[model samples]
Target: MSTIDAQTDSDATDVASRSNYELIIEPRKGLQLFDWKELVAYRDLFRFLIWRQIKVRYAQSAIGIGWAIIQPLFSMLVFTIIFGNLAKVDSDGAPYALFSLAALLPWTYFSNAITDGVQSLVSEANMLRKIYFPRLMLPLSAVAAKLVDFGIAAVMMVVMMIVFQYPPSIQIVALPLAIIVMLITASGVSVWLTALAVQYRDIKHGMNFLVQLLMYASPVVYAASIIPEKYRLLYAINPMVGVIESFRAAILGTTSIPWDLLGVGFLSGTILLITGLAFFRSKEKIFADVA
Candidate 1:
């Protein structure tokens, strides 16, 4: 056996035998179990991990942070031409460009976070095999880093709002809640995907295509109003529908709060968050060995 394995086995046995002679410790399923306190103990590493992700994200790109602005800007232009001009998509009385950009702001953040976060653990397998900080930090750091991009994109949205002469509503105060909804949705999916990713490497590429398809399916270019009233609830199951629509309502002052859709999103997002955290904790123990 390897030196580390020998030492670990010895220590585990010694501790168990000392605790109770009559009792036997058995292996548990679900891989690494969740340790809420342990994650908190490594808070410093969490902070550094978040910072490192940010730097690594923008370090060498010629456009640097400008990619954030360009992304939504380009999306808005394309959406305007195709959906606004060609399809004559209804935009709830707001200019199609402004309407689409508001939604794209949050949609971009959610898509990027999971798209990158799912690969965080697998890509850093070498580090995982060596270091002992909480494995959860890797996914969390990936999600956190995407917030920088979200912030830059948000600024661009505000600039466009002004240029387009769209005024904000009193609902603007709820903007942070909309952002939080998108973050929770992204992080929850990240936790599940990151854990499974270590076991299945093909998921990394598959997720990229899946996320792209999801963007077009979402309300990035069109308004929720286009959906017939009968199917609105069914459509909102995407979770992102509510998040994007709510963000647009707050900024553009046109789309009213889609409470029914928001309710579905909030429920789905919360469930996903809990499920992801539980699954991540369960499989954490295998990460160091597998990675």
Candidate 2:
């Protein structure tokens, strides 16, 4: 009987060891990262979120999508007055209104994405508590939905170029890359803002101020050529500098590629994108509860 009992105990211990080895070990809290596969699994939800955001934005608005054109047109007039006439800001020899409008197109998309994306989770807290989907989807959808507005603004840019009798330069080929940088930057900022906004409601109030400050700091009204060569590289760290400058370079045929601007913008955009995604994923688990 002792021999049989010993053999049975050895068998039980072996089974337990096997079970332990088979069990999947998940990381502890705060170490979690984005799960791309899970997001892919919920792809339909992502589409629905994008559609929902679009519908919500335009449903009751009187001007509807027309606001996209009007916003840039009004901004162009203001910039033409303040920057062109009052401040005597140079537009690289192009019309001040056209130059400002070209820059404003991408900038508007980015600004709106940050503003709307930050509030997305808080605004949809009820849906969050009731259902389980990738929380990142909220901000991502908000940014994507705004692309329609960007498209409209882009169309307006083309029209303005034609109206000004501006012909496309060979460098126009680079415009796609420029727009990609804008998207990445916008999404990156959205990630950070969304994560931070969840915990600090103060972000809601300060976000507008920060964006306005950023706009002035960017070369939106003035030409990038006006900045001193020594400071240009440092200034390019603001990704918008590269974007606005490059757009002008492409459309107006005035400046070069702004390689220095491109370098800083690309590096900063990449770093922000990585860090922002990590930050968003780290806190996503608690978003439903706190938002």
Best by lDDT: 2
The TM-score between candidate 1 and the true structure equals 0.86
lDDT of 2 by residue, 245-281 (tens): 8888877778777767977898898788899998988
Query: What's model 2's lDDT at 83?
Result: 84
Q: After superposition, how far is residue 115 of candidate 2 from its true place, in Å?
A: 0.6
Measured against the true structure, the TM-scores of the candidates, in listed sequence, are 0.86, 0.88
Q: How many backbone clashes does candidate 2 have?
A: 0
| lDDT of the candidates, in the order given | 0.85, 0.87
lDDT value, candidate 2, whole model: 0.87
The RMSD of every model to the true structure, in order and in angstroms, is 7.5, 6.6
Runs of candidate 1 exceeding 4 Å displacement = 1-33
lDDT of 1 at 21: 60
Give per-residue lDDT, candidate 2, residue 184.
86
**Using TM-score as the measure, which candidate wins?**
2
